[model samples]
Target: MASNKPALEGPVATVAPADNLPYGHGLGESGEAERSWGEWNPTEETVRPVRGRHRVAKQRGLARSSTVLGVGVIAAVGAGGIATAQDKPAVSISLPDVIADNLPDATSLPGMGSSSTAERDTASEVLAQAPLTSAGLTAADSEQGTTAGEALRARILQQAEQQQAEADATQKAATETAAAVEAASQAKKQQTAAEKEAAEAKAKAKAEAEAKAEAERLAKLAASYALPTSSYTITSTFGQAGSLWSSGQHTGLDFAAPTGTPVKAVHSGTVKSAGWSGSYGYRTVLELDDGTEIWYAHQSSMTVTAGQKVSTGDVIGRVGATGNVTGPHLHLEVHTAGGAGVDPMAWLNGKGINP
Candidate 1:
């Protein structure tokens, strides 16, 4: 038969079976089994190998965690890069030559996935390197940005008020100018009316004064004239055609009166003749300062002597039918400047006397 026991590799030791044994419980209990079973015993060598395997598994786990963290950091950097691209200014800005020296570079900042210690140091360096004025400007810019909108609103309102005030001033100036012009026009109109009224009043006073002077002249002329006789009737007018006169037409006015009616001189004059000549019997002739002779013919008697100065209203003769008369009457004739006889009635009317 083939050997049932297998060979041992290294140093081997054997232990005897116990004497008290249960039936069919020894290594030879089942002859058909090809291997023998042994009880486990802890040893330093085996425990040390198990401990090393556990350390290896821990190492693998730490490597996997580190890879995951790196992936997350790369994703964050990619996202930031995309955001920066999207937020880029439409036009690229170039720093001014003066300020370009003060600007910081991008590479000097902490990169993504950098060590925490490096990030903290970089942050501290950046803060320390910043100018004090720049830091203050950052804070001031934030505050000023917040108030800039309010300032703009206040300026807009102020401009609106200023414009409104200007408009009001312009309107007031226009109104005042118009009012002044209207007032001047009104004053001018009033002045014109007053001047016209004054002119009319002056003209009226002149006309009244002329009328009064004319009346006074007429009154003075009336005082110097007189009628030849009173209470007498006119029998014949000058230029009357009658067969009783020597001429074909009557050359004088005849006043029919009673036999002894008085006849007066018509004006202040000298008696040129008082005796009868022939046809003019019992006659009187009065000569005035203007050489106008007034003849009183057909008189019963003559009262004024020849060449005697007679005043107006002096009785020159008595009315009678003494020469070629049909009845008792006075024949009156007027001669101007030694000319032919004129109408005695017309001569009396020229002196403002209605005979």
Candidate 2:
């Protein structure tokens, strides 16, 4: 410390004062700096704020324009990799180009951690790879820098993975359940429809069978009343021409009578079977008690429905030569309840009215 120290003046600054002071070098103010450091009468250019604050310059440190540009380029490249590579399509694009387009978003790269893990991870990796001027960055990048990035990237990736897995599981489950339910419902509907159709068919067949059986029964009964008009003459008795008959025996009794002779019923019964019977021409049958049957063949005409009931001696048909008979006549037969044939004459006699 000097003994005769002069009091400092002018703008106060923490910097040390210069030792060399020339006489008559200061401005009108005593002790003013010889060199004009600043002037209040500033030009338009000076009126504007300085290019930057010293504090801000200090913060930037040695981060030059070249360094910033390189960092931006690196960040852009990394970001482009993530953006361009997202859900790769049939075609591919350059990762570097995409990165360049996505540059100038440094803050977001680190902040993206709060968002999707995948995005955060990608942004963090890009951010870390960028030539940074942060306190964490090293001046000597020659020592290969670590792939240091924010934790947001990993978190984003993890979240993405978890969400994708959940979505896949949900989709799979829905597909399986839908298929199963559809199959089950289809089977149930098919079964129900099949059952209904089958039931209806069976019912129809049963009804038809019943109708046929009833017709046959009534026709047999009608035949009973159509016995030979007058036992005038038995032109041919059943079994007379054994080999000539289909059953190796005659199935009916033939009686000779004038053509157009009134045929009458032999017993009280209902008309059952009646129709053209080929060689027998027009024929009819009557059903009686205990399901017994009587047949009439070779008739000139039929005058009754299948289920008409008649008393003995009732006219049922007229004798004719419509069958394989040489003369006009009537043919008759009797059948047991089991369908086995019997002597019609005997069956009539048993009914108390001799044929």
Candidate 3:
């Protein structure tokens, strides 16, 4: 008999002894017992039921547990060892239908034998080394698929660019506004200067016109007057200081000429006197329309009598050496309507005459 040693794997079964059986007759007494091996077949009535079904099930459970424990041990060994066995071909293990159906796959466990340990470790390292942020990526890394960190980085850059553009636009607008204000200010200043210049030109033109009109009026007045005598030289002017006058100063204009030189009326007037006075020889006094008086003294003759109407330039007297006279000269005097004597030279100049 074989030694009673344990089997490496499988379920063990137990059988019970049968009590009824056809015993083989001694040597020549074989009737129903003379059966060949080929003619014998098992029937339901020939075989008896075994009583160890529950025991077999229990043993199967134990065998399945042992298989699971063996697989765990193999996985542990593989994890600690080198992966030299990874190149070996896969092995197909066969199991009983009952065991196979109840067994869980090794890969389904927490840490099992799906791949080599070296391969798994290398994959973990690769995952750890991958960049987590786009900011740290190089140009080559940018070609890779976008991650969450890369997306966030792109959005931030875009927002910053937009804000910078807005700021530049605002600055440009402000510069344009300032330039426009400066232009307007310059225009206003130019307008003010132009207006002031125009006003000055207008005032100058008005002053010129007024001066021209005054000159024209004076020219018309000078036509109505004439000089008192002809062929004479002015010897003494009015307001002269000398001892020959009745007053302390000479108050008349003197015109020296040859004797019998004609003395004419200076303007249209009536002769008020045509006689010799105390110190005036052959004196003639003319009264104008405005009641002003003109005296012509030191005359050689009197051509007009008193109350005679004399026109301008009409002969009224002659030049002679008369009383209170130094030579043959005419002394002429003018008095205002209020009886005040004035300088004859100045009075003639006021009427547009030089002498």
Candidate 4:
């Protein structure tokens, strides 16, 4: 018999004893016998590894926890550092707020992810280095002339207009003066012609009157020199009536004789004039020396021309009442050299003859 080997130290496990059979048998409490081998199909106990030594070293929980810690560190870095920022000048230029509510709260303006401070500084430097361009309107003006040239042109136009106006005024004044002068001349000529015509008419009238007066004086002288045809008694004398005539009294002698008696000249004189008078019709005048004139009026007939010469006692005309006389008698008047008719009877008596 071999000496029994000492059991190794390990954890104890309970098992059933097998019966003695052949090369692979185990003793049991029962007197039966069983067999087993390493080359056989495995049993439950043989297929399992040992408890403490055969455990697996798993890492699923460790991998999950490490990934979560990494995500937390990244979130802390993304928040930046709002609490550690410094105070600086904050500039604000007002514009209409469009996205004020949606805008994120400002932390650090110049963080690793922020661009506000750098962008603002760059813009200010660019503006300071810029140059302003001047306006080009004066160069683009269309007119080529300067303001002085325009002023000169305006003065020239004004002077030309003034000269033209002065010339027009002078021409108008000259025309008016000429017209007025011509009108005044025409009026003067017309007035002179009217005065000349009136003077000619007055001279012609005076000449005619003088010729008529000379002719009458000659006729009266011729008629008075003639004698009545028959002698008769004198009924009234010259200037005998107190209130019988408008000229105070009778101016001639009256003869109470027969009607239609032949009358003759009492003196030698030329037959000068014969005519009708208002108070003494069919009258004649006879003229003598020293310019005395005699009248024989109220006659029926006369046998003499204006220039016929007659002798005293010649029957020149007949006696009749052809005037304002009431009876048939000769109306006679004598005149001085001054041509005023007077009483014929007084002149006849002064001539040494009975009237």
Per-candidate TM equals 0.47, 0.34, 0.54, 0.34
- Model 1 has how many clashing residue pairs? 0
Error of 1 at 60 (Å): 14
Q: How high is the lDDT of residue 145 in model 4?
A: 32
Looking at model 1, residue 312 earns an lDDT score of 81
Model 2, 1-355: lDDT tens digits are 1122121122311111223223543444655433332222223442333443422122221123334434533544444522432333323322334335645554444443345577768889997767554344344533555322433344578799999999999999999999999999999999999999999999999999997886676566555543447756865665666666777777767777887888877777889978788888788888875698877788899877699997877788888878666677888888888999887776654443354
Candidate 4 lDDT score relative to the true structure: 0.57
For model 2 the local lDDT of residue 174 reads 100
The model with the greater lDDT, 1 or 2, is 1
TM-score attained by model 3? 0.54
Note the Cα lDDT for every prediction shown: 0.67, 0.62, 0.70, 0.57
By descending lDDT, how would the candidates be arranged?
A: 3, 1, 2, 4
**Candidate 3 error regions (>4 Å):** 1-200
Model 4 CA deviation exceeding 4 Å by range: 1-229, 242-244
Query: What's the alpha carbon RMSD for model 3?
Result: 17.1
- Candidate 3 total steric clashes: 0
lDDT of 1 by residue, 1-355 (tens): 1112121122211111332223423445453212221211123432233222233111222123434333333444444522322333333323234344433443433352346568788889997765433322344556766344455566689899999999999999999999999999999999999999999999989889987886676567667878888788988899999787778899988888898899998889998888877987788888999999988898999887988998888888888888788889888899989687888888877677776
Error of 1 at 73 (Å): 9.8
Q: Model 1: how far is 277 from its true place, Å?
A: 4.4
User: What value of lDDT does candidate 2 attain over all alpha carbons?
Assistant: 0.62
